[model samples]
Target: MMNKHTQVIRIIMIATLQLFALRNTFSQATAQRPNIIYMMSDDHAYQAISAYGYGLNQTPNIDKLAEQGVLFKRAYVTNSICGPSRAVMLTGKFSHVNGFTDNHSTFDGNQQTVAKLLHNSGYTTAVIGKWHLVSDPQGFDYWNVHPGQGDYYNPDFIENGIRKRVEGYSTNLVTDFAIKWLDQRDKSKPFFLIYQQKAPHRNWMPEPKYYHLFDSVQFPVPANFFDDYSTRTSAAREQEMEIARHMTDTYDLKLAFDLPKESQRGLNSLWTSIYNRLTPEEKQKWEEAYKPSNDAFYKAHLSGKELAIWKYQRYMKDYMRCVQSVDDNVGRLMDYLKANGLDKNTIIIYTSDQGFFLGEHGWFDKRWMYEESFRTPLIVKWPGVTNKKVVTESMVQNVDFAETILEMAGLPIPTDMQGKSFVPLLKGKQKGNVHDALYYHFYENQEHKVAKHIGIRTDRYKLICFYEKNEWELYDLQKDKSEMHNVYNDPAYGKVQAEMKQKLLELKKQYKDPVPEIIP
Candidate 1:
């Protein structure tokens, strides 16, 4: 009955109305969803956080999350290494399932990841800072990642597949990019940001301003700083991560002023390369900070225990200084959130890829089944959800991160994702530990000579299997929290050992991990 012109106009009007209605519906849904800011630091140990009561250093900004929301006591990693832990976090699966079992492996981008899941669900997702996965990040709408284990000074980052070297300290630059992304992100949809930091990792380097921040403070050495691996497995003794023996003067302690010429062969070249990356101004600051210490080390002929203590002090100070910068940047990010009024509706989760050894068991690196390396720091600040400061002893792992984020955003967790959502725990609907027993497997055998191992940790007991060596170790955590003794052969723990072994087998099956052949 209508003319051609009138029919065309009517069709266009209906289409426009439908589009508007759909957009309005999406906007209302997005408003109800809490925005997620997942902040992770590399090799950040639980012992380093003041909120954990270790008192090694003060992280006031990180502690604020603990004061306002929830602090997880037993937050562990599926694997206690950088790349694999991150892969587990993204996929909510074990290392075997994710296909990134170690640092050397490239992350399979085609697989389902939290970023992809969130992006597909209409949430604007971005990942900034250290993406050590060895491949271009996929599923993220925006990605600015470190090329590899990014340098601490004047690092190169790959932004949306475009590589460019940025002139600034790595931690600060990472934060800057994150803030910039937030400012320009789509405001109509809920955002999920993976804001990460590369501070406090290996070869610790702080911002110039914080280079000597911990100079005056003499940190207390761990009680077992002079650990003799008499009772432990052969793997413990074979480890090349000992602070006294393995830590290099040139590379680790930054003591290059007076060293034997022959001592400059191995790691010195690498150290020299890193030192060369610094700008003139940065080099000046570094030289000024370490000159006095280097001079004193050369003057005082410290050897044996005294030399180890000196190395310990230098390592601790440098590491803590880097941690201080990370904390400062966290405060910066928090301030930005509050200023933009994003604090009220956003959920901030601060954690680490995995924990590190802070002179624990006389070691300086991670990848052990030991508590220091296995346990990471997790602090969640969920506005409108968490009303008061709650310290939970509930055992959660990095593998659970993806599911938790998805559930918090009111999205259905994919069936393929292996982690259980802790939304019930967060909402106070459930109590105690979410996991009955936590499984861990470390596949990397090249670095620091930490033997490839599989392990299980229950509430009060831990069982480790160095399957390659046909060796088993058990720790009664309630009795020996430091894990100074192995009770696997103790007659009194026979029943406990049997139970743990059975449980371990069950867990291996449950996680779909293949049992390594023990050459018994």
Candidate 2:
């Protein structure tokens, strides 16, 4: 009914209004930095998350985040150990550059951290839950942390340098305290929160509420659960972690015998207190859940491959149960954000310090350059940007986490930081050269008897040097995805090996790692 000029004018007006609305949204977002909730779970393997399609277990709550935003397909960590990985995430640098090579070393708190940068930029910072770097957290206005690895039940927490005992499950307590801080934070300014989870770390501790989760469930054992370590170096053979051999009944399985510390296993007071602090009803429930299985196992005297399968079943169920709590607690946090109207103004990231072995290659712990241990799971929900689910094949390391958070806040990354921010990749900008390969280093000598190694993973090739034993391993990920066959000596791919070795040296040099260790 309108004239041609009038119709053109109407079209321009509609387009102009839409553009204005978009600019207004962008302006409001610019005025306030996004609140960051970085949730790093301990030893949460990608193979277990349903989003990854491994289907080891169902993680509905965690899958929600992946469905809502970007789920990284090839995320990894600079170091596979806990403390060093956390340290690297904090500093935006590799283990060698940050000086936290392994769990044994101390994290210098005075050094610059992402928390410090955020704090300086008018963002309130808080780090709750597991902070295993052995340094009292600096730069955080409020930090409530677990001492060492922390206890699963009735755990003691060090809050702002004051130790306090909270009577509840560790995962729930962490959420409770984090919410308390959130309620107390300055609403006028944005915030950054590190909600780290200590769940499913070691001893496979699960909350009493989830004690019987997988009681009747039967899990299939890994194809290589009975790996003979054949054709591999002593590092693979001598490793001290295995579901069949290393998992202890006294320390790891909660069979109380009051054995000596070393003879019992690793860390008892926490695992022991879990049972000691259980209510009568809770204790009865736990006994009811585990008694039949424990008694049957002790009487069976499981050995050989039969014993291995039994151990695998027990380990898988307990580990999965612990994982369920993490998913639930993560849901709790996400619910809090949504209920508080913070979801749209926040950036939520779910990942782990490093990946754990869920019975892959007959291994239990992370530290090797194997895919299971080397790759970490990362799902990020950045509201107003990656609002829909998207998956990226680009390689991202935990070290980049700090710089990414910094970049999201429109801040410059410190020159000392070795990692480049992948915010461009997250926003689908189709810009920036992120990474073609990732470098990894492990330097622990005896905790798990894993070889100290340095490695690099390219798009389809992986080269690792177990310099401690002068052992080299190469895997063609496209051809042998399982990494079961080492092809370093294959004449057919001699050039590929040489190219990977060159890249490894270049990365080590660029990252300032010890290059001398790479030589055969």
RMSD (CA, angstroms), candidate 1: 2.3
lDDT of each residue in 433-455, candidate 1, tens digit only: 98999999999899799899998
In the predicted model 2, the residue pairs found to clash are: none
lDDT of model 1, residue 226:
87
Candidate 2 lDDT over residue span 71-111, tens digit each: 99888998898999999999998887788999989999898
CA RMSD of all predictions: 2.3, 8.1
Model 2: how far is 286 from its true place, Å? 2.4
The TM-score of predicted model 2 comes to 0.91
What candidate 2 gets wrong by more than 4 Å, as runs, is 1-31, 255-274, 277-282, 431-433
Question: How many steric clashes between backbone atoms does each model show?
Answer: 0, 0
Candidate 2, residue 503: Cα displacement in angstroms equals 1.3
Cα displacement (Å) at residue 337, model 1: 0.8
Query: For candidate 2, what is the lDDT?
Result: 0.86
